[model samples]
Target: MPRSQAATIRESLSAQIDSGLLPLGSKLPSERELSELFSTTRITIKDALLALEAEGRIYREDRRGWFVSPPRLIYNPQYRSHFHDMVTRQQRQVETRVLSASTVLATPALSQELSLGPLAQLLQIRRTRSIDGRVVMYVEHHLKPEFFPGILQQDLSQSLTLIYQQRYDIRYGRSRFDIFPSAARGEVAQALTLAEGSPILLVFRINYDQHGRIIDCDHEYWRHDAIRITVDSHVAAGE
Candidate 1:
């Protein structure tokens, strides 16, 4: 199938960025100039810009025109069932900075969420997630070390789901997610390279096991402009 004119324009611009022809934060040509250069209508150029914006590659300024945006944070909670999996699935370049990992006594809130015993020790892992070399989100996860023996030795930059599936034969059952607008805290701000109290999206997720045991709990804070979440629902035939 033939690609649309807008798609072609988007591809051309994307190639420039990828090849370092269009450096980060550089302003793109004006809509009229792009239209003339591509031999397309200005409307087509606008559509291309919108597509790039959706992908987090560019943004519009009031009077300064369009400019390359910082890298976008990709979150695909739908498949492979882990942050690293979702990121790699999009073929996006990324880096994970492990902020802290240690065995700690579960707090009251953590114990209740994970259904842990009062004195249970949880393996807490915290990381800063980056996309295309830009910090984008802060993540904190808790797991039962007893269930994931030798987990500390594994490379976490890869999918956690892969590790459990390959090493322990553990598969994710169902998950519950809650999202809300929030203000970034001190450490979260530093990790995400944003100012303290910056607007962000806070996500809380609970992953359960086949036997209904809660296996993991995660808290993620994402930059407001770098992430998006989509949900879809369908009615049953009987309904």
Candidate 2:
């Protein structure tokens, strides 16, 4: 059977993308332009583009046209590297946007995790992280306000490791990380451009000061397809 107009458009675009004619991170032509080029209706052009998006070959940004999907980032858990440094090392551009910053009373669970006294206040920073212009992770960080005075007043989009060293002469020390597979839901899913209940990676980390004091706790929700985690293992005596 002959292919429909939309299917033909889809196949042509897919072929271009597969053949590297449409490079990664490159934006597709506007809907009107595509419609004219394909000599098809706007609805047909949209259907073709949507089919490409559904295949993970392209993605859309708010107010921005669809772009070719970039490759996934590689994360090495055993390395103690800053987010910006690690991402740059992988040759991918990474950007962080602070979604919300506020001071709130610590919940019982949070209080215990941070070992805070009664009625402790925590500075909460929520952020959306994008790799190669595609939002891939949503993070929430809870910090004890007493350690870093006026932290909320400073720019939170920059690397926190640099901020700690420059402002307070403090550096990150030993840390604990708990990573697991979980469903992305609610705001996290929305931030990563995925549907609710989509499979995602959940990471919980507690950062400590050089003196072994708990500095902050972070919860990160990641699009599973956007990252591959690897950890190096050492050989044991008996192995």
Candidate 3:
């Protein structure tokens, strides 16, 4: 399939960032300005920005406008299974500001996604993910607390995947993912330093284990300009 217009805009902006045409902390052109430059509508520009935000490439500041974000460590979902694992493997300085972490009754959506029965308790972890001191992504994860005893006691700044590996010996297996462009929610805007309705990428991931048991469900909001996901497929020799 051909890439969408938003995807094209995303690539153009990303190229600028990669080539240092737009340096970290440099303010991006205003929506009106970008629309004029791209010869498209402001709405298109908005969509493009949201895509960049979800990739953790650019951040918006209240009244100050959008600025280029620091580079994010590339994370290959096909190979890496954990956020902290991928970041640490890249040797990038990473930190998580725990926005909220507590046990909560699972909502219907959470229950359905985690494949839990009604009334199941869920451990909710909300974090603002930062790299090199810049906020780039906001994540909310739902996990069954019963499966991960004493999880709340561990240092959340470390890799949650590693924690599982050491504590429970559970490893991530195959997963399904869906990605799309979205506008920032109110809290997401605040966390990513973006305006309400700023552009971002929404990633919904469902992870499983060796036995095909659901492990966790993750909702990741990335700065649109900061990352790109590449998928390659080929048929087997026999096929």
Model 1 lDDT per residue over 112-224, tens place = 88888888899888988878776777899899887898787778766677888899888888788888988777888777655456567899999987778789888988776
Could you give the C-alpha RMSD of every candidate to the true structure, in order shown? Answer: 9.3, 5.4, 6.1
lDDT of candidate 2 over 13-34, digit per residue (tens): 9999889999977889899999
Task: List the candidate numbers ranked by lDDT, top first.
Answer: 2, 3, 1
Cα error, residue 119 of model 3, in Å, equals 2.1
lDDT of 2: 0.84
Query: Candidate 3: where is the Cα deviation over 4 Å?
Result: 1-22, 28-59, 69-73, 88-91, 234-239
lDDT of each: 0.78, 0.84, 0.80
* Stretches of model 1 off by over 4 angstroms after superposition: 1-76, 235-239
lDDT of 3 at 39: 89
**TM-scores of all predicted structures:** 0.67, 0.71, 0.73
Model 2, C-alpha of 16: deviation from truth (Å): 11
Report the C-alpha lDDT of model 3 over 87-124, residue by residue, as the tens digit: 77777767888888889999998888787897899888
Q: Each model's number of backbone clashes?
A: 0, 0, 18
